[model samples]
Target: MSTYLIGDIHGCYDELQAILEQVNFDSFMDTLWLTGDLVARGPRSLEVLRLIRKLGDSVRIVLGNHDLHLLAVYAGIVRNQLKDSTTLLLEAPDADDLMNWLRCQPVLQVDNQNKMVMAHAGITPQWNIDTALQCAREVEAVLRSDSYPILLNTMYEDMPNHHHWSEELSGLARLRFSTNVFTRMRYCFPNGQLDMICKDMPNKAPEPLRPWFTLPSLIAENYSIIFGHWASILGNATPEGIYGLDTGCCWGGELTLLCWEDKKFIRIPYAGIKHW
Candidate 1:
């Protein structure tokens, strides 16, 4: 049995399908681990969601920032930003089903047997695998509950410089930070301060802000984390147990797939630019 970990799909269903076809995916013998951002910015968001849903237990997705935003928008908690491009999903006949499936995804996924942890972004230097899992479950519970709206209402914005996982924090906001840390996080200050506004690669980051992958911590040194969402830098590359799957499929870059067991990579060239 082979386990393939795919980077951020971002609704590039055609590229996803082509990559899967090239890999000769077999539902009976293969498992797919997706590093979130399963929808948005590209065409065919609905198709991507449907294909994953159809695959069922054969696939697992760690929630991405885009996925969380979709849930928030669908729940009437947040609106899209200016660059939003998920009209295909909104118009899909199964939009409700797509949203439901997305909300069910976890923020952190780990295969202890393989010692591989997957998230949309990188785990904080402060969090070990266990702490990360616990926090992810906490937020997952709220996202899955009927009070999801209340949680969503409080979900946006950056968190306190130092987060301690408090019960007083809104569940949606909790989800937001967790999502940010695991999926959207790129750089943080040396003392473990997150700088959310910086989107450049670590080399160009202002002094004191180090890439999460380079943090000198037990989690960084101990576990193998497979993540996407930082397409501008580590595109379709695997280095030192860190895999970046988001080859900027939405931005005319390739869509990459990595086979977990062997670390083999496959890529499908971007077809064209998508306006919405």
Candidate 2:
């Protein structure tokens, strides 16, 4: 059986299907790991969400920032400008089921048997794999609880980039920190402060502010880390033990899928709109 890891789909359902065809994906025999951002910014968000949900155990998906934003929208915690672009999803007949499934998806996933970990963005330099998993569970528990609607109210925002995490952080602060690291994070300071404003290519994020995977604290990691969420990298990052699979398909680049067993990238070019 072959295992595949795909980058962010961002509502590019056609491209996703093309890549699956390229890989000859067999739902019964092959497993797919998605780097999240399953919906948003493209033509068919609802279709993409339904297709992945239909895949069931054949797929593993971690939540991405866009996915969380969708949850916040569905929960009535916030109204996004993307309302026009996302109306089809929010108004879908199965919207509640889709949103519930999405919120329940973890921000971090650990596959010890495969010796790999998956997060939508990248793990904090402050966390080792085990600690990261524990942190994920903390957020997941809250997401799965009765307080989830209340938590969504505090999910959106860029301020308060807390570098150090402690058990002392409960309520909104802790959940936001966990959300940022697992979803919105890309670049970070050496001291682990998140750089939320910079979404450009790695070299353009300003010096001293490095990609999260390059942090000195993470140099000792022995297992592979798979992530998406950095479309600007366009699947070009070659950092050791780090895999970036977002190829910017929503912005006219290619959809990328990596065969876990052989590490071969299967790319499908976008044939639709060139700019979003």
Candidate 3:
């Protein structure tokens, strides 16, 4: 069974289909692992969600920052950011079901069988696999509960009470910290605080805010991680086992997929869908 890991789709349904066909993804045998951000920015966010949902158990997804923003918008916690496409998803009849399914998904997924960690954004420097998984569970619990909207309402904040974890953390303070790491992380200050605002390349990430993977704390963990968030960096910021899949399909860039078994990249160029 071939397991394929795809980068940020960002509502590029046509590209997603083309890539799957190129790989000849066998629904029954070949597994599909999405690097998240499955919707928004492109013209077919709703179609993308429906297609993946139809794939059922064969598809594994982690939530990205955009995905979380979508949920927040739906819950009336935030305004819609996907003016181009997400409104279609929000207006669809199955919007409730789709949002429910999306929120149920983990922000961080640990695949011991595949020997990798999957999160929309990269993991924080302070957490190892076990701690990271535990933190993810905390956020997952909040998202899946009736109080989910409460978290969404306050989720869009910079950094947190602290960059590093502490056993004393509780309530939204703890939840926000973990959620940001899993969905919005990239660069961080040397003190371990995430640089949540800079969506630029590592070189442009500003002083004291170095790429997350370059930190000694995170590098020491040394686990294979597959993530897609910083499309600006694309696949250039590879630090050994870390892989970036989001090639900015929403911005006229290509959608790339990585074959897990052999680590091969299968790229499908965008079909000229004008986002502007």
User: Which is the leading candidate under TM-score?
Assistant: 3
For model 2, how does the per-residue alpha-carbon lDDT over 98-211 read when each residue is reduced to its tens digit?
888888888887888888889999888887877788779988998888788776777666675554567687767888888888988888877888877777778777878888
Q: What does candidate 3's lDDT look like per residue over 135-197, in tens digits?
A: 889999999999999988777666445455676778888898888888888888887877677
Q: After aligning candidate 3 to the native by TM-score, how far in Å is the CA of 200 from where it should be?
A: 2.4
Residue 172 of candidate 1: its Cα lDDT? 55
Candidate 1, which ten residues in sequence have the lowest lDDT sum? 161-170
Cα error of candidate 1 at position 190, Å: 0.9
Model number with the top lDDT:
3
The residue-by-residue lDDT of candidate 1 on 1-276, one tens digit each, is 999988888888899999999989998889999989888888778888889999989998898888888888888777765465676677678888778767877888888788888888878777778878888888788778787777566555565642433445554555666656765687777766667878876667788777877776556355688888898884533448676677787788888888877878888887857563
Candidate 1 collision pairs? 120-183, 121-182, 121-183
Clashes of each: 3, 0, 0
Better of 1 and 2 by TM-score: 2
The predicted structure with the larger lDDT, 1 or 2, is 2
- lDDT-best of 1 and 3: 3
- Let me know the TM-score candidate 1 reaches against the reference structure: 0.90
> In candidate 1, how many Å is residue 209 off?
0.5
What TM-score would candidate 2 get against the native?
Answer: 0.94
